[model samples]
Target: MKQSTDKIAVLIISAIKGGGAERSVLTLGQGFHELGYKVHILRFKSLTEYDLNPNLAYHLLKFKPYKLIPNERFRHKLFARAIDNFIEKKIGKPDIILSNLEPSDRVMVHSKLPNIMYIIRNNISNKFRLTDNNKLENKISKLQNIYRKHPCVCVSKGVENDLQARLGPHITSTTIYNPFDKQLIKQMSNELYSTPHSVLKPNQYIVHVGSFTYQKAHDVLLKAYAQSSKAYPLVLLGKGKMFDETKALAKSLGIDDKVIFLGFNKNPYPYMKHSRGLVLSSRFEGFVRVIPEALTLDTPVISTDCPSGPSEMLPASSLVPVDDIDALAIKMKELMAEPQSFRVSLDESFLPKNIAQQYIDYLTS
Candidate 1:
């Protein structure tokens, strides 16, 4: 594959937080850079939690304060205009622009930018239900308009289906799974921890890596773990506003001793590599990156058959219904009793190079 030395691709997102969407943007940016496309990242905020490729150019936009405006729609429009002006001044126009999340996508759509690709990162139906304000009807109307104006890319087929259902079938879109860096994850997993933590004892615990939030359904995970008869402990990795509440839930269930909370480890691959298995109890997902990451490491995985991602990635046997404590417990116990029986095959279609090339082809087309 010959490198495109003259092409430039700009990736726009809210921030470089340690979430699946943010990580996907970073991976795509790195892939484009490796392919000799001059890549740039335009983020809304300056706070970065993940490491970025040094070759990629980074730019931050400072949004104007609109606290006086009570209507979020107006505020968003104002901020979108500000972002348009910022891009014009700082980076000018690129060969292509890949924007992530609703805010960035809305901005790009409103900007009337050519060769813009909007990446939808979650189950839109579930996310709107969780975060939508009183103007629900109006919100959907605006989203439908945005979808009609741009070429959208969803992280999974489930997400794509949900989006078309919500915005009408005429909305132009395609599915592009999130890319994974297998070599990087494997290398990180092999690196010795500077300070070894006792909670990471080999084959002694099942691991769940995600934010402790309502969407992640940590409460359901705790309840399932309590119901299961498995002897291995459960480890929760990552931090969120619901940390204390989730801890209290574990205590209330009388399984605090068996549950360990290791808040936000930057290198969770080492822990994932040594764990008995990885479990995802998300209420919904765009595409569960951890499932593939675990499979790449040969770790077994069990996930809730949520709205968007799990059913697409895992076999029916490895999935249980969302928030179904009894079924989740049964699956957990089954995996624990015969861990080797539930290994998932990693899909090579999501390799970084392949997905990146798809993006290039789409943008150029």
Candidate 2:
């Protein structure tokens, strides 16, 4: 068996934060460190605030150190090229390069480096909108051709299937589920996972933990919560630019008081563990890790049976038709009315350490 000391540096690039892919990369980097590997994470731009383990070595490929100054058209291109070239030179020939953030095209430039593997970790599914679907299908098709010359990995089997279906067999891809620290999640849950909104001195409430974006379908979630016959407060956590529209929708539906927007907070485990049950109304997903997260906390879940994940992760009894606010409302009411019977545990077969070993085996093979 090859010890972790034999492992070379695994580099993960981040354009910015506040995305599942970014969060997964950070979590994986921490896992690598825990496994006694020499791990290094490189970011295109310096992070303003990142929650990361202090032991890992993080590199920010910034042109200017003092402040983040956005470069102009040509200058931005040159800056990007410079960063790519700098990564190739200073990284001392990495064993693998994990691309998690946007503009995945940057990997094409670094593909020049010899003896280094490429792992493409994607989190979102390609079924949201027509415009995005068109763009992604095209780009992913091109990436498929590129991967024929050099292979890479995908985040989930759903994403792998979508890639192969769109780009054809020329793309070589395999699914590696996101790795979350089970011990850490347990500890975090134990410390912070209090009854939903215990801080607010309340016990009956519905919780949603995700960015306030359209893909999350907060509008439908709120509409469903409003329509639900159960009389309980709804807590919407996480921050985003779309808050005003979602808030406005709640007011229009005349349930503004019933819905509470808690903005963004790093520690949402407490809110999640304490809530009556989690309500996720995503349009699509590569795989919803939060489904398992909620289950690990023994929190009941009521999710829209979306394309690739929620239904597959949770029991069929917990799922409802996508965009069907009536069904969603009914499901939420069912869980709320029967909290004792609703609580359930997530399957442990796909735990983080096991998933990490799967990736390692595939990469080494």
Candidate 3:
């Protein structure tokens, strides 16, 4: 058997964007670097928002499939080969390879790359939106084809179970929650930061930090916020395609003035640190990264009991049913009426070093 430090880990993703999964993937790369392995992040795009550690190797490919190739499977094979050639020439073969997100998963499905594991970041059933049952089944079949090849690592047990139910029992999978830089999160929580929009006042606002996506269910959040006792101003701290539409919905709900959109801030910790509480009203999530971030700051959080994460992270008291506006509104009011003495501790296993060990154990097993 090889020593742990002798193993090389390569993580492939689209890019280092401002999404939750990307954030945790970067932290996981850092964890591998800290464990004394030579780590590399091979990405298909050059986009980056977060500061990267200098110790880890990063290869920016900015890849696009050649549409000239008629067959999708054959095209993916060539794409995978291009990546494999670069890895062999520049960095040698990775001892273990892990793929993230859909684009990367596409090539990795046909990849002859060694010891590869596909990381399922969300609930498989909710992976797409389709009205036709046949279309949905076709999409599910595509995913089954990709994930069927390798041993999988899901971000939550809920995701693992979803995969089993959706894709059947042929594949092997396990749950490994994303790693958080707990110390960094705690330190950043104390930071004095500024946003282009209105300045955030400490202990005076309820914060909801997620992109304006269908999965995030911001409409539900806004509707529920309007019905709540209006105890605190709401701060939304991310941007998406539905941002303008969501803002319009806020006005339609007559709570536009009470809701603040600061777009996407790289450091949302300062806001989380001083907020009254953090709220997540999602339809589904791989796992809400902010729940751990808020808990690291000792701030309370309320989330919809969505698939793949909230239940694993928060207690029953802090959860509400998904898409239930009335229940969420009542919970919000209860949160405000009760004393703000909620103290919760996130598990130490969330720390990057420990989470990295879980990955190592899984890959080496």
Which prediction has the highest lDDT against the true structure? 3
lDDT of 2 at 279: 81
Where is model 1 more than 4 Å wrong at Cα? 1-5, 64-82, 85-89, 130-134, 194-199
TM-score of each: 0.92, 0.84, 0.94
Candidate 1 residue-wise lDDT, 23-133, digit = tens: 888888877877777888998878788877787889887543554668866776777777667666666666778989986776666675578888988877974785557
Question: What TM-score does candidate 2 get on C-alpha atoms?
Answer: 0.84
Q: Write the residue-wise lDDT of candidate 3 on 1-365 in tens digits.
A: 22343558899998889999888888898788788778889998899987776878899875664557888888888888888887777777677788998889998888777789988898877766544876887887888889989889999999899989989898789989999888888887777877555645777788899999998999999999899998888899999999999999999999988899988988999998888888899998887898988888888888899976989988898899999999999887776566264447899888887888888899888
Q: Candidate 2 lDDT, tens digit per residue, 223-297?
A: 888888647788888788788999999999998878888877666667777778788888777676677777777
Worst 10 residues of 1 by lDDT: 191-200
Ranking by TM-score: 3, 1, 2
Cα miss at 145, model 3 (Å)?
1.8
Residue 151: error of model 2 in Å? 2.9
- For model 3, the superposed segments whose C-alpha errors exceed 4 Å read 1-6, 65-68, 195-199, 339-342
Off by over 4 Å in 2: 1-6, 63-89, 108-110, 114-128, 132-141, 145-149, 191-199, 349-351
Please say which candidate is ahead in TM-score: 1 or 3: 3
Q: For residue 326, what is the lDDT in candidate 2?
A: 89
Better of 1 and 2 by lDDT: 1
